[model samples]
Target: MGGLNSNAELRRLLEEIGWSPYELARAVNRLVSPDRRIHAKTPFAWRDRGTVPRDPLPAVVAGILTEARGEIVTVDQLWPGQAHKTEVWLPAVAQIAPDRWLPHDTLALLKEFRASGKAKTHFAVSGNELTSLAESWAFGNHALMSNRMTAGQGRITPDYIDYLEKDLAELRRLDDGHGGELVLRAVVNRLAEAIDLLSDSSYPADLGRRLLSLAGQMAQLAGWLGFDLGRHGFAQRMYLLGLRAAVAAGDKQLGALVLSCIAFQQTWRNRPHDAVSIMGTVQQGLRSATTPRVQALIAMREARAFATSGMHSETSAALERAHQALARGQHDHDPAWVYWMGPTVLTSEAGRCYLHLGDTLQAEQQLAEGLANLNQDATRDRVLYGLSLALAHARGTGGRQDLELACYEAGQVLPMLPEVGSARCRNLIDTINAELRPHRATSTVRTFIDKFETMKKAKIC
Candidate 1:
């Protein structure tokens, strides 16, 4: 309090909330562990002396303010200089008006999204926003837009739509092999072309619906690629735009698919409750339309969220549900997107769930089986799951032999890294590397570390 400078930003925020410094401190302390509680006077120093508290306190204070104000109150807003330390920032959820789903409105939204360029900041839309969007998609009735092209507009045909669909399929295959970073630009370009067709071409009602569906698919792919590259804000926008296109096209199944993608993103970001909530909306909304494959996918995603949240019983129940769904066999009505959903993929995901649940033996068994059965061409999946297996080994209860096996598994993944451009794969590798670092004195661990360092120097891994 004796410092010459005052924390004007902190003071202003407190004033707006009508909170005294002590109250702010009290609120923050309530959110932390008892051992880490702050003194009641701590906020006075922050407000009057320009002292920013350490890592999690600033985040906690900002969260308290955000909940109280019912708006986003970020660490950067409260302490501008500490923005870089913010690990995750979630914006306030915007309410989606019913009119926002209109075809023309959806088109305008896509146009604006295209012009916005790449996201400059790293942030996620609030979980409430995601859940709300999913609920709207599941329960709402969106009319199929009538064709509204004037005379002399560019004409479209089913053949052209077929060609576009094939192209998108090829793009999906490319993403599977080469990962999102290598394929994102191509997906973005294709999505732009789809948007152009929607805006500039005149088509009959059927063709218009197909075009909208195609645009929605491309937008989902772009969103997925953006997510894979860790551009979450950009990904969220793309997903919402895709949802609008799906609604405009009156494709409930596709809307469910997009919702599942959003759920997966939430799960990956460690927001298990949000992921579970979004999946619940998806399951409830798609009850009549879901095929066995689709059912399996949803159950698997729910299992993942449950595992992340340490709900062991719930996770096991969800996994059993996924297995039962898959055992029911595929149907002709299954969407083409579910082509990649099979026993191997399900097993691999189960392994990932077990890893999250800290069941290393189960993780090792499932991941190994999935890797053994995986198609050789599935480079990105192989790399990601391989690293997960390595992590399982590194965390095993066995002695030095387990550490050696972990090094070997990680080494197998390194060669594939150059072909796979997934940031997720790299992040997993980094985790395994961190685990092995403490055992560097072991000969096998030392060798693996040297090789890893060489790859880093060469920008290969």
Candidate 2:
């Protein structure tokens, strides 16, 4: 594997694409942050020998660099031989019949990313040292926690969060074919060990916030699967646990974020009013929180809640608050969690909120802008965004091609459900169908329905 020559390759690719480094930076910045000014520092970090990008960005950089060079750099080229053609990260790596392909395309995607990026470094999941720690903690007495509990090591590093996000993606794939039940059971077992560590461990007192935040995330993940499976009661309970853990961790922001999961769960239950109320809890927490990133998330969730409940005015107001909150985020925020609260997320949330309010024009515009800013590898988020896009097209029922494309993206979650129990995603499918029902005889609409059927058939979630 080459020394993650991302910088060197990026430099070369710039020339190959007839683009200047500043130009590329400007493009990415514009996409990522059209409102708050984008600075040159955002994209130049790719060349820094000592720096590695966060989750979605590294994958985004791989694609962008490859597109400019007119060739694929590949995860292997960037990271190297640690991963294989059959890696589960890729969808094609899984060679099974579509019917029996419980987790079809498990390794199909990793390959695409690998092929697109030049060998930057051999940053395979297998090479992660955190695996051992996670596995060990899984079997440990306190494994019930995931730093989300109340103790143990916290914030291993910014990179650790990225690795964990990758792990979550892998888990999503497995959950598709096998069902979220299997994934939940497995995570529960592993989390038990984490709980043991938290209960028995003693560490720097300052680590408490990190541990609680991580543990809350784990609980939130568990709740998401539960929501997907229609286990409304279970999901709500899990969310409560995660929420409490978040508070104990002294991460009111993360706690509010966890509550957003619950708000989403309520939406899935067809209880939009309940969803609205749940988000209220999130709003209070956000008010007391320090960071704008957390506030953005809280506001976005509130916007979603209001929109789904048919409160057009409230939805717009909440969305405005979401933008205002995001505007407050400076580059100096903690790179780990805060980086996720980028412009893409803000716009996507606003778009989603608007979609539910039946404002197709506003939703369409926000969705387009948000997608342009988003990375391709954030599979879970991408899937939901596609749902929003489909809704945008369905307003007048003429977007057959667009609907079909959205169907393809929805397949990204085939055999695996997202851990972010979002009632809204499923609702989007229903909304699209309702809008197209007047023309169900059309082939494109028919195909879309067929996929929708498949989604519905995913029993037990």
Candidate 3:
């Protein structure tokens, strides 16, 4: 009915594929709208485009034509073969759409584990599976990667981190619908396996480094899931394990990652003092971080801890340090493991710190910059970018418009929700709820509070 597609390539493609323009629109809409059932005439107004659908939709448009004609519609037929391949192939750094193309079964499994955020099932760590995974992780292809990615394994670490990152955002966005419902016995079992392998003295340094980081990563994820599920003891144990593993890897960057990371987890339990304590450790640990970017990481985390404590002075100091460190950038002497600790990362955490300090304006300023600079990797950075935006808006405006904006920012992060264990985010929402209760205007704020409550209740903790 609309002239949006008249005689255009899109319209021609629709005719070529035999799909009604209406049907194509429905599929696109359905993919984006998880809650909405697909229906024709769902409108694909140009004004409505969110993040551009990861590429290949044009090919899908071709495929639609192919499907319509009952013929194999090769993308190559539509575009030249090389051109077709180039068109559909995602950037190595792109977040979704190409998720299915990643080959590492273990990585995908980790992604699934994080996205699920369930840990209610009592984990049993025994038998062949445990020992096998440990052995492989501790002694497996890490050496091969040493030969392969020695040029930059730190670069790769960020990628693995990204896979988990997307899942964390998704977990947060879902609030608590299935927050603590998934079985994590398998993940725990695997971690135990990694622990076994890591403990062996025979492990090579490079392999040990990689395995330890993975172990730390696993522990970090497990702890969050545990928190979500309300298993505080278990969560704490896992965080401790993450700490130990990160240290063993001789990866100060990862240790910094965990130390500051645990600060977020501590904030969830209302342990702002403990959060501050952890941040102190992070600062001390940063002393040894030759990497300027790693120093930024430490500063950002410390700022977060300070903000959670409502210590505006300390928070400001930390935020300033974070920026200064980022300005210093990653020196050549910094370990490859710290490769992703760039300015964009600092901006994200700085935004978060400012938000918690009740400086919503400052928070928004940093957040906008952070989101603008964030690369399209799946790592925690992207999730945090969106999360910082949400928290900033939530605290800044606390109005219906702000709440809706926060929710939308939070939604882009649904796929990576679980890995983000920031008690700050949870507390921020609760704070927003308290602020909104007296207003009695937006049911949406109440709805948000209720949703997070379900998550809290549903979380195994």
Candidate 4:
């Protein structure tokens, strides 16, 4: 973790977490090897001269930052462009004592490792590993909080927290209509503003909890936007921040929601094994959850994870459970977070599951039903479901007639792409194009590609 750059990012990160050079060095030494002591001057040199430490030091420093800031911190952030040499790794060298107090070091390692390159490759996280995390969070005595807040002169009230909550709700609407790319900057700005307010203002304990919960909601929105944009690393970091905020707010529901969101995102990204692992841990974490809608959401995600793994029987069983769970849910009784959940979401997810399981007819039927229920403002989701339907038709044995219908779906999506500013939409379109490449000679396929290309040109112009 050394070499040819400025330490501005390092200094800024350390300052944000209120860690001095000596404290950081001490933390690093304790993390690296308790038997050995590293002088404070070592950190000062590295900080001042960009002298990168060798071996596990980079990962140690990252773990320390993850603990301090309650967010993921990469070696690349502390030492930019060093992944090639460092292997972009999170070392599993340390273990925590089985106490009710979740040690900062252990929490740091969990956050860092979960978002690391290794987690993506080593997708098989065992129940034992996750049980430890659950126990750490469930019985931990240490409070989870961001270091961004300190004493302030201004006063905060319940009304102010309510206003932030309303704003967060509106941001979710914007994401639905315009896609994450168009709304992410606003979400990030709002989150920053909320953190600044928390840092600069004083409030009653109850109001403080409400304000922290509001901040968690904003962080969750930001994380969702990042996931929509395919910035997986950034998305994981935001989710960690959201989880920390939720825990600090004493909002167990929000914490579980964030975990569910992460699992769903991972499932969609084709990491079904990891997704299932996360969902299992989340279930264990929320064993006493009172929200049926949340339970339904979790069940749906589990079904998707099963589908992704080609476990059709398990998928069917999970879907049945999910539908039954949803049937028990009342719209008014659900949280604002689950307001977007309903028949449409269920249908679309079921269709995606069937599509993955190679049931083209069932996929097409469910997808069509979902699309009929979808609103015009949800252009991004509409386009995604349309693509899934088109793909099912393209892969079916129904030949030329089905091909024509598939091309028709492509035509529908092409016209709406400009209105939907999602990276995911573009990626899905590219995937569809790739799937149709073998049939480019077909009249229907040629027509679809030509129209899609023309739309792209129009968008560029």
Top candidate on TM-score is 1
Give candidate 1's whole-model lDDT. Answer: 0.80
Kindly list the per-residue Cα lDDT of model 2 for residues 216-281, writing each as its tens digit: 566666766766655543454455445545544555566566657766655554557656766764
Q: Output the TM-score of candidate 3.
A: 0.48
Ranking by TM-score, best first? 1, 4, 2, 3
Q: What lDDT tens digits, residue by residue, belong to model 3 across residues 1-461?
A: 33633324444455565667477766556333355333454324321321122244434434434323433344444443323342332211122121121223323333433443243111111122122322222222221212222222223344444454454434333332233434345446556555454433234446546765676666766665675555544564465455445554555566566556556655655556767866675555454435667777777777777888899998888878878877875577764435556776677767777776778887888888988887654344565467667766765654423667666666566446555444334444455556545544667655655665666677721
* Maximum-lDDT candidate: 1
Task: Kindly state the number of residue pairs that clash in model 2.
Answer: 57
On TM-score, the stronger of 1 and 3 is 1
Candidate 4 lDDT over 253-351, as tens digits, reads: 787778777666766666667667766667666745547787788788888878888898989998888888888867555667778878798999899
Give stretches of model 1 more than 4 Å off. 1-5, 8-71, 74-99, 118-122, 147-152, 397-401
Clash pairs detected, candidate 1? none
State candidate 4's TM-score: 0.71
lDDT of 4: 0.70
Task: Give the worst 10-residue stretch by lDDT in candidate 1.
Answer: 87-96
**Which lDDT value does model 1 have at 277?**
87
After superposing candidate 3 on the true structure, give the runs of residues whose Cα lies further than 4 Å from its correct spot.
1-190, 198-217, 224-231, 246-253, 285-289, 331-340, 375-434, 442-461
* TM-score-best of 2 and 4: 4
TM-score of each: 0.81, 0.52, 0.48, 0.71
| Rank order (by lDDT, best first) | 1, 4, 2, 3
Which is the winner by TM-score between candidate 1 and candidate 4? Answer: 1
